[model samples]
Target chain A: MSSIIISENDFLKFKEYFYRKTGMLFEDSKRYFVDKRLIERIEATESDNFRSYFNTLRFEASGDELQQLVNAMTVNETYFFREEYQFKCLVNSMLDEITHKKKDNSPIRIWSVPSASGEEPYSIAIYLLEHWSGIDKWDVEIMSSDIDTKIVAQAKRGHYSPRSVMNLSKPILDKYFIPQGGGYQICEDLRQAVEFSRVNIMEPADVRTFRNIDVIFCRNLLIYFDDTSRRQAAEMFFDSMKAGGFICLGHSESMSRISSLFRVRKFPEAIVYQKPLEAL
Target chain B: MAFIKKQTSQVINEDERKTPRDFNGLCVELNHEDSKVRRWAVRDLAEQLNASSVLVTRLEHEDDASVRTAILNALAKLGDTIAMNGLVACLRSEEAALRNEAIEILKELPYEVEPIIDGLLTDADSDVRIFAVNILESLRHQHVEQWLIGVIEKDPHVNVCSTALDLLSEVGSELAIPAIEKLKARFPDEPYVCFSADLALKRIEEGSR
Candidate 1:
């Protein structure tokens, strides 16, 4: 409701409440964004007031409703191959080194956190299949996780709106996705390649369950977290990754502000974070 | 008669002697260094059903995760109001992890937790209030909408107001229009609140229509 005036004190409380729950910082500059979502929920619940609703959110056990609130607040605007350079880097250099370093034919694990409706992971699968020539010899395991159950469900179904695939070349689209209804459904083989799970990185328990990740694609999600949350998240990533693992973040995000746990590795194509093999 | 008494004594084993049967003994066992002993004590305490206070206290200081979990299970099984108290204390905690864990426990017994919901709503800490409201989110009773609306009109906290309004938007009727309009009037500078109230009013109008 445009008329719902949130006082500065209330805004601060919301900021704290949201940060504690989701670890995402709602800064003063993002007031408009936060306010719009908060208003929508206020109306959705039909609560006579804000205080009670906050109480409900704080104490609710299932976390389903809070997840719904998070989903409403977040904007997942992603497309296939949104950043071309990263894919190029992955195909040209990263894979060669990773594959060469392997003693046996152990599967290379790639994690895509906040996989946002399946596009990114599927894009990865497609890229690996098309560009990486040695796919037959090595096993490629992709695990994708998102906080939003609704989005995760969408990711599992492997159907895409035309807008989601706008960046894909026609040949790639013809080979990988089958045209069904108005949107294209990803082929069964590619769909099955990526495993999807609902995970919130803010929760320590949830992050601890993930282990031995070779590479993590956590692009664009860190910008939402506060400094403390970002550090915690960075540590979680570091813990989850195997030694010599690589982390690719959004172009805007840097690990320096969050933590020094990850070392900056400047690749010709993109800057990424790496867990040193020598360091614990 | 002496020979028969000696035979009875011989039949009585050390295992039975060691196991805690009384409340005092079990309470002592709860603090045992060995987790298995503590777990056994927790389970037996649940069977006793009257040792809820001791179990709740042990749940607070218990270092072993399994032992703490066992204590929680025992308290839940006891179904005493004391268990509810333990959970409410967790709601008051500053630690989000503990608060979340308490919420999970309280979620199992929504009916038992209903009475304290109001107290939690009025808690000094905003986080506590938020957690209390979260407990209410699971309940879809007829009175829940009224309770939420009440919070909207009375609660001084903005997060609380926003939370209640969010619930009201889903559960409110045309009757809530006046209160929403009043909310809009109260905060002319808050465009988001104003916009939310306007939207809620529209939804109410639409639902009535």
Candidate 2:
């Protein structure tokens, strides 16, 4: 066992640095989470103490370690169809608009901005396959992205443990996923529906890569950001969407407080927004 | 079906058959010609069983609308983000009912819904637009304030504009005060906007006090 003891000052330093770099606000109460995750990092790195690990993180490297630090710090607790109503809205309302907006040969694009562990994007693939009959008529592309490279790699594998399939229905299980030795593998068709990549929501990137997206599903991940970061991230989503494109959020997320470019729509239990047909 | 039968002998008794594989055979029934079989299979597979590759594949190819809806519902119950892209594709179906069902599933996962909500706001269908607004209000989102203000400032539809005003009042933040002031200045004839502005101002004063 690595005898790495994290001090209060170390926790504070990480909190401040993480807040500054990633805009993830960690209060004093999160000392335990910080200490626990960093201790694991220290053990993995084979460092004897917290000071050496902290020093290496601070000085002996570029920003690569920062990502592992952030990954260790982040809580990636997510599951398939975690919120049922929102997916209903995506299939019911948003899909109709995309179908209406598409030209005969135009490819419909979708970006899952924080496509954690591939579940969200794969869920989307399952929805498309189940509902849309004229699949070959449209060129459909689903781009699933995340900031954590480790999670991105894991997501790309398209495999899940038995525990990970707890929420999945048997019919859906039998249809879209195949059983591997100890885990489940998403079917090739659903797996092929989306292309996964590593992306930081906060950093500047080639928006054109996500261009012409008819809809984007960036659910639940924004709560980790501060107000300014949220605003900036929302703007990025706005810029990335095509005219009259749609954005779907987590059940608890709303744009009412941050942006003016989108038109808010309501369903009984779901909320979706659309970019204006023209620029705001 | 074969896997389940082979594994059943490993179980000591019928009551002890709790593994996810017990429910594995339903995916074949999900696409059967009989609607009842398909529906039953979907229900059993989606609610009780672990995700199976075969079932997901069959449901993905099932031609019947009801069967498809059942499959989507089952996927939603599973909450697996892996199916998100497919669910998103389902949102583009020509049938309004099918599309609506897909949106309903997306609405349940707020964390996964935020980025997609912005795209949904500009949908040509008024009902879809309204659904986006309701979701935003529930999420207490700060990002939509600016867009809501713009809607109030210029949306051709009266209901859309009014909904924007209502949302601004509900948010009750100082950031909206400027937008409300502008609405009051430009849309002076619109009493609802004026009323909302006044109410927001009153709320701001009370908060400060």
* TM-score for each predicted model, relative to the true structure: 0.45, 0.44
Candidate 2 Cα deviation (angstroms), residue B116: 38
Fnat measured on candidate 2: 0.00
Model 2 chain A: weakest 10-residue lDDT segment is: A55-64
Which number leads on DockQ?
Answer: 1
| Candidate 1 lDDT over residue span B1-209, tens digit each | 00000111222221212664688988888888776577657756777867889988887777654456456555655667887788788777666656765665564565676677778777888777777777655453445666677677777777777777766665577667777877777767877777788777765555443
- RMSD (Cα, Å) of model 1: 15.7
iRMS per model in Å: 23.4, 21.9
Q: Which runs of model 2 end up more than 4 angstroms from their true locations?
A: A1-76, A134-136, A206-208, B1-209
State which candidate has the highest TM-score.
1
Q: Scored by Cα lDDT, where does model 2 land? A: 0.64
TM-score of chain A of 2: 0.70
- Model 1 segments more than 4 A misplaced: A1-75, B1-209
Candidate 2 lDDT by residue in tens digits, A1-280: 5466666655655666556445567787877777888899888878766655654554332334556776777656777766767777776777677788666665677788787789888777776666655454666777888889998898888898877778888999999889998889988767666777778876644332455567888876765554335655765686567768888876556765444447897766577888777423
